[model samples]
Target: MKPVLIRLLLLLAWAPFYTQAQQRFSFEIEGGHFLKDGKAVPIISGEMHYPRIPHQYWRHRLEMLKAMGLNTVATYVFWNLHETEPGKWDFEGDKDLRRYIETAGELGLMVILRPGPYVCAEWEFGGYPWWLQNIPGMEIRRDNPEFLKCTKRYLDRLYEEVGDLLVTRGGPIIMVQAENEFGSYVAQRNDIPLEEHKRYNAAIRRQLADAGFDAPLFTSDGSWLFEGGTTPGALPTANGESNIENLKRVVDQYHGGKGPYMVAEFYPGWLSHWAEPFPNVSASWVARQTEKYLQNDVSFNFYMVHGGTNFGFTSGANYDKDHGIQPDMTSYDYDAPISEAGWVTPKYDSIRNVIGKYVDYVIPEVPAPNPVIEIPSIRLTGIADVLAFAKRQEPVESPVPLTFEQLRQGYGYVLYTRHFNQPLAGMLEIPGLRDYATVYVNGERVGELNRYYNRYSVFVEIPFDATLDILVENWGRINFGEEIVNNRKGIVGPVTVNGMELSDWFMYRLPMDGAPGPDKTAEVRAGTPEASFLHRKPVLYTGSFNLSETGDTFIDMSAWGKGIVFINGKNIGRYWQAGPQQTLYVPGVWLKKGENRIVIFEQLNDGPKNEISAVKVPILKELKS
Candidate 1:
């Protein structure tokens, strides 16, 4: 036979095998059980946000979940991380949802996509783009026409990236969540009519369907909140729920008493705020819960088998009648089965043992631990004052203080300057201070106001014709509860002196989107004296450390007060002396073999020593009295 004819015959013989391997399958919730290809399958899943974990570590984290006997990997697609600005969409690099989903499928694991227009995953603004607040007549997560229109556009754009990866399209994505925890929001919001909430949720569901997300849809909320959160025709799932009886009852009540029940967000550990003690769930208790879930045939997903770093300005705030504005700590660790740096904990082993007993197939061995390294302390010299950099930019003039949203600024600090015509001394009150503010009178730091404690007023003594600069840092937008709608960073309303309102402001946009480089530092250092640079204020410090080899390391900012750290131009995360999180996780993949740059935008480094050490472990809790 001729070589060409033989090759053609071989290709024809293999065609069917290849086609079958890539064939799509039906995934349905029927007879109270999850049916994949007409066979009942128990979904043991774990939640891990793609944006939270570095793109390079996605496979390792997913593998960890599979080894723990989780057949599925669930993730929340952060919209803010994608469309950072209005009309500017990004689905590349770390923000690539398609690649992440495809990677999971390649590893023989299914995906549960929770692409929320409002995820409320301790993410800034519940994953809503900052520009959404700037739109006229915009009301988020509600029946507002502008919000609905924007949501449709966002979902349409998202589907363009991952629509082909749906289970119906030969992809691993079996189910998708429609609007996260809407029932909680509806319950908290009393002013908005219940009918309006229903309309908004229905609109989100329609939008998801219209965007070609043909996978089975589910709505996750607390068991009691199914009434407000569940959309018509979508399966209702519970969060933070374990009782099989209650879970079945809620799902049956909202979803026609069907059998396939799922606890969409089973909380193994709780989220931590800056000042509060780091929350830790007992490993044995979690194991017990897992056994209960499996024994009762109730499918469950660990809210975060591995809660990666929040990185950049992504960590969000939580506000309620009891807690007020509690901004989430940068380290999203969640104290899950898998640590923030991808290290398996006792919880991981506990959960694995529980799952191994129930699964029919052999669980894969846990992958080897990632390498971790420690570097000696590197001295970071004060190179620039944040306000000094702000002075270089032309200020936006307004009669009253404007918000970070009003100025079209998303994250970081915004310097609001007001020139006092005469010497004014009184209780200066900023009624609309969103989060944290540092008051300065003519380059002299006076006092500070923290929104976390609801302290928006401070005593200020202004010099004649002095410039009153209120440099406000946007800790993060409220990600949970009803306060999310009221989330406008920086100065939102009027700044009053005693009982009178102050006016004539010069707002400098210090969004601090990127770390200041040597060129910027040189300019500030050369222009200012060393004596003036050591003041207790927000200062930019720069330094470099040599590394022979790279591995995962934590940048210990225990010496520093509060600030954001950037390594090799990458925004690692924020650090504060407020306790609970003292070190920022720096993935070794981001480092080079030789010299690596580190920049600290220190908000309050009062001590003489200006240094940070690359430690081996994380310091999650250090509660100050």
Candidate 2:
């Protein structure tokens, strides 16, 4: 047998022995370090979100983290993914938090659970359920009574799922984080009293403790914002902080000058938004920081050692004083050590080398990359126009446009239409446009408005008795900053033309939660003529391709425009021609060895060609400057 093959075989045989079921162990913060069973242990950890990854590949990803010399795996429990609706909880399949933690424990890895009532992981509404907005007098991340009551209920339910997995209960969970980065939020909103922030933080901490999370608790924030975020009894940790001296000083300052310092979220690479260049961090630079952390005995967890994809409409946006609203791209690759497709980059080797020098145990061999395959071009034809379907829905008539939450809708598109009796021509303004919108007058495409660019108004010439339609899409809610609380989708305020408020409006909700199919009641033809399709409205294109063999592949949507893709009824994610990310990562597990269905919801595809290909590689950074 070949030497390489023999080595691999031996390693496989020894892996189980090395990762045998861990005995009951005690983990606590003591004397400036993490003490596991009375021994000081530096926590070499990395962040990986379970919902972002396919459940079938969870073990593979965990093993890859182990191979990188990480002893602990930290994950944020996104509340939105589990309890999507109020009182409607789901913990099975991909949303299984217990399975994820158990898989980590089985791999001889400790877990640090960040069960956030508010996680802010660039997720929709900062990991908040959309139903929260519908609650009467709801104010999140504050000392509001309604918010607290709902938060307690959600946390109580979460504890029921994985509370037994805590280290205190003889499981692998060593630490549980309190509210994520509360200090940053408090700092942003100066109008709120400091006492209210303190009360809210205390309430969240109490809720976690009361919910049976007996594991050592900690709160993470930027080095400068520790004052407002730190819980009284819990250990305080820094985020995005690399300077060992500053980190230690800040933690000490917050925790009464004591020790047990840790950097909860050390960044290897930064998050990328659509239309921007993919952020890249040097492997050597990260290695140097890793070396410093080890040399100083500072425990750290890479913010994302492996950032998976943001499937469906779960991606969030960010708003600032300078930048209005910047929506996150579909790919959450984050340029981490592990790629979104579960392949290790040079950064993985660099960090592993640094870790090997400090760790007592041997680092496992890097796991082999997942297999990939490519498919030939597949032609897709338009089946139904989204606008036509919207017209069929019974409209909600009101004097002004209502928000998505007011309409009992969550994420998707909403169409606001109005018919004018007189010919009014001027600038049409929708100042409360939540995200993105397309304007159409008399079945003709007029212009597009994007919230990312803060373009809310556009010129329009309306003929007498012409019908006007404004199709607004909730790209994503703001996950970070002070604007998060006020994130209401659709038109929240009045629609004006020539400084006059328009009244008597009709609205249709197009959640687009599932792939659009041809309406059976209507004479909707399956492959309609391209010229006959309404260019102003979104179109559903469908096609099927046979695959004798299935493997992981990237659906190349470069030929298409802005829209979402669904494979075999699974909503993979949204794609846009705005560059940065052009391909959607398709896991091999989602494919079969027979014919696989593909559907595309093309929003702005005015081009002639309507086809896509399944490529082996991803196109994450194709920015058009």
Candidate 3:
């Protein structure tokens, strides 16, 4: 294999990361799916994100994926990960998307690029940059002149960096999506007009073509013939919504009535969140569809071959009660064949057997599984009894009002504070508080406004000569609804306290970047560990374990709360006490010859220096999430 280096740098914005780009790629598009240049490419693609998985395991994961007979790799371009602010973009470290695509090229695989200014990959803000929320009067995901205008600008900027990588242009990318599943949900037109949708779709295609991306631009839809289907120039394509028969209909419809088929989203698993029961997508005869497709010569991409971490507040959710309004959990362990900790789940072996039939080379042996951390349940005190550490710090600026986009932060809470110049009494109303809110009068907690129920306003009573504060926690934005998607965190509308509207001067910032580690002397509060309550939150816990041998171990995290895990300072991404993701993987490379330190930040449980043991990967029966 040639040496490959990838730079996630946003090109000319940040100093470039100096990683090798793969020297070559092989791709050929016939009726549709890309085949190796000289061969009839019966391609297999899997969806996973380099940013989602730990940076260190990119190659290991890719190698394993390829072994599964997946010749094509697909990933989403999380705009937030690149451009947190409008002009500033970071493609280095965890944000190194460029390196990822280029590396996939190096691995002799073709790639599908899902560069959505709004990719609803269960991401914090559906992959749209937070800055969009600050555009004043901006209507996102809609065809509003303002919305499309910004969309064009973002697309233009993005194309400038990777436009040349399209497959038609001889680059690794075979397909590029024009906004994920737009046809399946409420298009700006569905709520507005059909003409608007057509125009919006046309305009997007024009922009992509104008920017010279050259690759076929496809739209991913759960519904096949609604309008958008993938064939690009001919018709757009559709991924079956967890149903193989339906998937065939969509793919067949795209090929002018009949042909081989594929599912852009062959569900390897399902997504879940905090307040709900586990949303499980287990293996069964339906799960056999993956093997079935391969056996039948159909080309498809696993929506998420490897579900990675929704680290920080990057997880997303649907607002509709039918789908439940809770935000997604921090851990995105989609019950994929390849576990988030990077283990080869039993599901992996099952799919590999199904795919092994068509591959040219002998399937590479799956790497030995990582060690599992067999966490022994134990409880700790005093740490929970410690005093609040952040209340004493200067505290993040909160007197000035801010929006989720303005702060350049995504999912999570934002606080806005301002002292009332004159005192007045009436029903104070904040026409909107984005999603959720907690009101404080002179630093004393008063009450909170809840939006989990579709309420539009929060009424608070404020007094004279007092500093009124509104702490808005991001309960999660609406991922499955038709309303305000640009629905960011913080105060979304007018602010009124006690029937008196207060204007001018305010402060804001999530202060959720995380606190200054753990303190020996700190106090803890219950009922709000997962949300940012500042000082009342739990302190980080750190410990060391001696590995009798330096080997890969999946840190058994079944006993912990939601937060991140690190081995000897190497981040293994986010984890949750939630089942299905009870392990935070620690590759042997990050281990020490004797002892290794492991640090954890439990968002909920404040207990124990638990013991960990490596465990087996979990896959859906016929597939699992």
Candidate 4:
């Protein structure tokens, strides 16, 4: 064995008592309780993802969590955010995992790190790196050789950064989850065999141990997942907002009638998707549910004390067996105690009061809310032709339509264009359109296709022989269940016209990371979209707004169709006129005192006014689903 490998193994062997002589901060599981340094300490944690929030505001949000009477903060380390591409890893800036954890520790807050190779946090590809899909026959979240090899490397890198930071090594991290909600998915989806599911869970626990994580590793799942998700050594924990009786019963039964009762994910409010209203679990409901758990002396963590934003193209979707694909909204304001803009809601006050009644220590005062500003309508100038941008792209010729992964593309839309020899008019079938697409023939918009409702094929009529362009947008990947195993975006099958499949296509990778500089943008007054540009062709609308003072505000994007927004140079997130989310939250930290640039990549715009404004408050809850 290599010297470094031997040294790491030795360190793993001494993990239990690595820092015992210096600090008495051990967190171990005993009979129905978590013994912190041999004293029973109730863990009241709240889930807050760091990548979703700005790195500058992590401390501010942590303070709010502390004031809410939460002793611990739980967060999932999204693997894809760090390893955007295979063999290359990033742990700096917003992707810095150690800094977030260390900051929580500085504030005297314990940590529960859920570093799942597959987190399923409504994040893109369930936190799996997109490059994983490019690997031949790569079966993820399974006991596959290639997948495990990659997973081991990732965990090893994670341990190198935060291993010594574990509670066993005098750090604030009390516990770490083996994998997130795998049991719930196995039972519900059953994509893999039962024995393989069991073996996969055991293998993951082993890999976590080999990676030098000597702290108590546990499995988190819903009440029904114990049978499939729990292993022999790892403690079993349930997740839910209410049903305290059932939660305790299942967990107790799983551990052979005696074990620590931990609700790893107690949902105060649920996740929202595009076109659906934001989830609205009442503050009273959360207070009552928490009181029940506290009354029973059961420990729990609020799923989202503050859900920031999905930001960029990291949001994931859900593929239901009946309802087809449901793409998640960009704003991850999980309607929790703390709002996305870091404001304390009524739910925060209610949770604090209820938690205070149970804990002996005094709850600190809630942190003051952040300031917000409303700006007048900002007129959009400079219309940059998107087709011109496409002309500069290097096109790949393929026999049939190729998936985004097949072409080595990560996120954003892909343009698939082909010229037909003869005039054609019939039903165009894209059997495997992953998400949404816009069909155009001879530079004219034909129809729209959506994956959410399973609109796979669209009828079209063409006058004569002309070029056909099918621009497909990758909204997001499925984050959960069996479908996620192969959630590759773009068209995976041939484009059939009148039952005849077409061949020889030009594929363009539009990751939309950014665009050409000022030379590409045309300086013009804001009005209806220029008729010269095709309606289906993507347009880059650029504008600037001057601000004397800056604070957190929401940009009203209701006027725009489905597309992405960029403030200055930073990519904010996607915006859809779909009912639920109509605005994008803009943190003041991203803004400056002088002129701030704004760019919108609109896919379709049928609205009258072409203006963007700032609102003081975020439009969180809209019409219900």
**Number of the predicted model whose lDDT against the real structure is largest:** 2
Each model's lDDT comes to 0.86, 0.87, 0.61, 0.83
TM-score of 1: 0.94
Question: Model 2 over residues 283-337: C-alpha lDDT tens digits?
Answer: 9999999999999988999989999999989999887778688889899999999
Error of 2 at 280 (Å): 0.9
For 1-625, candidate 1 gives per-residue lDDT tens digits of 9543464466456544533555467788788889999999989999998888889999999999899999899999888888877767777788978779878887888999998988888999889998888889898888889988888888988876677678886778999999999999889997989998898899999999998898899999999998899999788989988788999888888877676888999999999998899998999999999999998888889998889999999999888687578889999999899999999899999899989998998899999978999998786654676777888889999997888888988999899988777998999998789888888888878888998877889998887988888889999998888778888888888889887899889999977678888777543442246735557767788878899999999988877788898999999988878877988999989998999998888777475445669899899987762
lDDT-superior candidate, 2 or 3: 2
Better of 1 and 4 by lDDT: 1
Which portions of model 4 show Cα errors greater than 4 Å? 1-24, 189-191, 520-536, 607-610, 623-625
| True-structure lDDT of candidate 4 | 0.83
Query: Which stretches of model 1 miss by more than 4 angstroms?
Result: 1-24, 522-533
Q: lDDT (0-100) at residue 467 of candidate 3?
A: 76
TM-score of each: 0.94, 0.94, 0.75, 0.94
